[model samples]
Target: MNWKGVLDFLKEKKFGLDRKELVEAETSPVVPDDFCAEEVVYEMNDMGEREAIERFVPPTRSTATRKPPARTKGHSRGSMVDPRTNRAITFASAHEWRCALILLASPEIAEVYDQPPAITYVDAEGKKVKHTPDYLAVSRSGKKCAIAVKPSRRVEKSGIVDTLDRIKPILGDYADDIILLTELQLTHERATNAESALQAHSCRVQADCDRVAVIMSGINGEVNAYDVAKAFGDFPRGMNAIWCLVYDGIVKLANPALMLADHPFVFRVLQATSVAA
Candidate 1:
């Protein structure tokens, strides 16, 4: 059968023939294919070139079977973090790894140095861990990256061993670009594992932090602009400087963001604590 005749018939919607009769002709027959094609061409040509070229449209219910409407899945939810843009710093959470990052983004020391490199912390399981390096500093000589700072009392031969044990992977991975600082001094061998890290933290004490206190007090919150050298001092055979954690060109910090962001988590955390009280 001629598909053209069928298509033209569908388009013109001409089903029944014009021929009929009361009793003489008896009934109307389907239009002949040749006649239908001829009529289609004649009608189309009469409309001229552009009009004669038919447009294509998907078959609708009148011309073809229609499918039901499709079911659509909706979008997921968004974060409800009341913008903490200008909120207070969360000093308590400052001890936590991830939360401290918000504090680091605002470091005063950072201003003195180039920005910290993008940092990422990952666990042994290959899952990503979030940590703000404690310090990253730069000098004419080179760069540094400090992952942690242990109070002086915390330094022990074993302490350094454990300290290096835990943080070295990150420091080593981050090596040559940073200088890890701590109250405790360590032999190259001791600073290698978690056991050593724990030992280091154990030695830290209120007095161990006295040097840091002096330097910190002197900062006057002008970290990005302050002279870090004022905080600089020599350590005992095992004593470390306050800038110990300085790494690469950026001075990383436990709470850099607190020093950096307009709304540090310290104020926010304090606000929450105050409200709770």
Candidate 2:
């Protein structure tokens, strides 16, 4: 058949077109744009080039006045991320690291600066001496405390306790208070609890925290922590919130020595004999 006869046959077969439509489609074939074989011209501009670099300021390292001293034989040196500010806190010894953890765990403490600048003062013998505190802790209330941490054995031999006592008056010029912390103060329980508190503080589940807050709000006296945790339907999440409340001093653990889940606590009342370090 001829093209016209074929178009007529397609229409008769109901191929979705009439003879007039078929004729228009066959005549209106798509035509490509005329090709320009010459190489295309290009333009470039430096509008935003280096804009980010120009606006950038190299971040300042840290506000800490001095860095921790070099690691010597038999001495430990390291850094840990502070959960409060998410900054690294340097330490010269394991004791210092534990001290930092304890201080960071405290809600009262705003920041802990390691290796604060040396404090020079005259000892009782009238000789000038320099004492570099292990850590300088700033409380939320703006109180500055210079901390000297040492092992119980070293405290007496090093005479750090006496040294701090003698130079405390002079150090007062630098910090509001001079604290001497020995191994006696930094116990295993306190350090463990501090670590737990840090983890609890970092918990980001808002729903679990809100549920805990609701349970705590209704408590006027002591309550079983496990029961409160079970109320959340998810025991682990509920317990995390309870730990957060304890970490924040919103609750007082009765037997802090007990495991996190076993402790009974009073809401909104901070106890003198509490777990805080």
Question: Evaluated with lDDT, which candidate comes out highest?
Answer: 2
Number of the predicted model whose TM-score against the real structure is largest: 2
Superposed by TM-score, candidate 2 places the C-alpha of residue 105 at a distance from the truth, in angstroms, of 0.9
lDDT by candidate, in order shown: 0.29, 0.66
- Candidate 2 pairs with clashing backbones: none
lDDT of 2 by residue, 1-277 (tens): 8998875565444423234443443432222121121223334448744332213222234455777678889788887767556577887787887798788888778888887888887776889888888888998778899999988888768878767887677765578988888777777666777777777666535456666777767777777665676565555566666776666666656655543422344455634222322
Residue ranges of candidate 2 with Cα displaced over 4 Å: 1-74, 255-266, 270-277
Give candidate 1's error at residue 199 in angstroms. Answer: 35
- The sequence of per-residue lDDT tens digits that candidate 1 reaches over residues 1-277 is 4997665445333422222222343433322222221212223355464343333322122110122123335212111110112111121111221222322322222211112343455555667644433334332334444444333454463244344444556665454443334423332222222122222222333242344444544333334211232223223201222222121112233343222112111111111110000
Error of 2 at 153 (Å): 0.6
Q: After superposition, how far is residue 213 of candidate 1 from its true place, in Å?
A: 33
